[model samples]
Target: MRLTRRDAIAVLAGLGVVGGGAVAVDQFDPPTAETAETGETGDGGGDGALSATVTATMTAAAAVVYPSQTEGVADFVETYVVGRARDESRRDAMRDAALELDAIARDWYGDDFADLSADDRDSLLRELGVAAADPVADGTVSERIRFHVVNELLYAFYASPTGGRLVGIENPIGHAGGTESYQRATMLEDDAGRVERAERAGDAEDVEGSEADE
Candidate 1:
């Protein structure tokens, strides 16, 4: 099944996967001073440090979910995933989720999640039913990983200015009036068409109401 951004959002929202907001996008801020120094926000770990294992697991997950052929994906993971996870109040949950993913990998392939081949990792995710319409309802460990880890990484990606450009959003939120040219993807164009149609329908209703009043 093809997963559009809208579908992902709706499914996550329905499952209450994105806590505290409609989407996890609002949960992130730019990296902090401490994050720059230590590559973490110091909230997820016991010593307020991010574990390398957790970092590796999340990075692997990001590769599967938002596989970019670009050179800076590691930087993106640090800036987006680590940076956002650090500031998040639910940072502990994110940490535990990473460990859980590692455990799953060890159980299935006798290796850590980061050590798995790309194909094997993707296959495992598929086996865990990550693409299921309502994985959360089952309350399985795999579903929790998908919700807490995969969804968070995905939010970090698509909400960033760089990720936005992939789907034709040049300036997502902060970088207004950016000069980068954007070619709207078919999905975005469809979204715009839906919004336009909804507005036109409302206007037609208003006109009919006015005529009836006359």
Candidate 2:
């Protein structure tokens, strides 16, 4: 379903991001330093480490807008957020964008954003995109809001095993492809010879038993 600015904002607000606009955020400076060197889970993805109330609120808000939640999803953000989501300066942009989208939904629908049905959610999302087409739209709601939601949806929508199924990738890495020639060719050579010898011996024994019976 298409996502609207309000749906995104409400989800972010639920996550913890406060305020609005394109940059309603700060660097994701978790008071505790969970650097890559630490080799330990830190704030954002690790145990007990929470993000900026605002960023988290925003992330959570985006989850709601997308209407999906699964394990380890937030961790994907923790590992990748610092490196890829955006520049350090716009670290909180994702969260903020989500919140802004949710707020827009709340204002337009006159109800809690999460309470909407799936069909309702999609309709609102399309409307948000349409509204942004109008140059005179108010507030921070814009096509960019849709972009943020799209990013969030990419993550949230794919959080399910169902999503993985859709993409044809299994959870655990399967065996790397193998060569038929290398697997049994060498190992079975001696084993097959031994089996043939044993079969011949067994045939001789069988002939002796048959003659004795006759």
Candidate 3:
């Protein structure tokens, strides 16, 4: 089933996944402006840190999940996922999700997800989605990937200004161009006849009153 941007948003919202306040991974300081600009997480920061490897994995995952017919997907992922993620814990979740994908790849094919052929990577993601949907299992890794990684990425893309344009939304939330005021359809034209009739009745009433006075 091909999911539209709206559908994806609804799903994420329904799951209570998107707007939750940030979770702190640890005491690691947030990314500096320079680090964010460079898209590097710096060195020796452990599981919570965003590294080049994590960035690469996220880039690959974004490509697979939200493939654009046009280009600039890498930049989009960097801006939305790496740069604009709500807080450190959110970033950590993204990093961990990528690592989870790698772990799944290793278990299935003896390779990292990044090393897998495109077909294999896609196949593995499909399986991951299936596993995530099991009703009996709650808070499983598959469920986390589905919500934290895949759904979050989808939300980020569609909620972005560029992604919004793809689906005909002018400017999304953090950018400019949101509607200043929502204009409702006016019924002036449809009500024109009724207005004219009321005017005529008032005129007739005035004439009758004048004649009675005389």
Could you say which candidate leads in lDDT? Answer: 1
Task: Return the TM-score for candidate 1, rounded to 2 decimals.
Answer: 0.56
The per-residue C-alpha lDDT of model 1 at residue 96 equals 72
RMSD of every prediction: 14.7, 22.4, 19.7
Cα deviation at 124, candidate 1, in Å, is 0.7
What tens-digit string does per-residue lDDT give for candidate 1 at 33-71?
A: 655566543332233223667767877887888844534
- TM-score each candidate: 0.56, 0.37, 0.56
Candidate that scores best on TM-score: 1
Instruction: Estimate candidate 1's RMSD in Å.
Output: 14.7
lDDT of 3 at 88: 52
Model 3: residues >4 Å from true position, as ranges? Answer: 1-50, 84-86, 130-138, 172-176, 180-214
What is the TM-score of candidate 2?
Answer: 0.37
Tell me which of candidates 1 and 3 scores higher on TM-score: 1
Q: Which stretches of candidate 1 lie over 4 Å from their true place?
A: 1-50, 133-138, 173-214
Residue pairs with colliding backbones in model 3 are: none
Native-to-model Cα distance after best TM-score fit, residue 18 in candidate 1, in Å: 20
* Candidate 2 Cα errors over 4 Å, as ranges: 1-87, 130-140, 155-162, 170-214
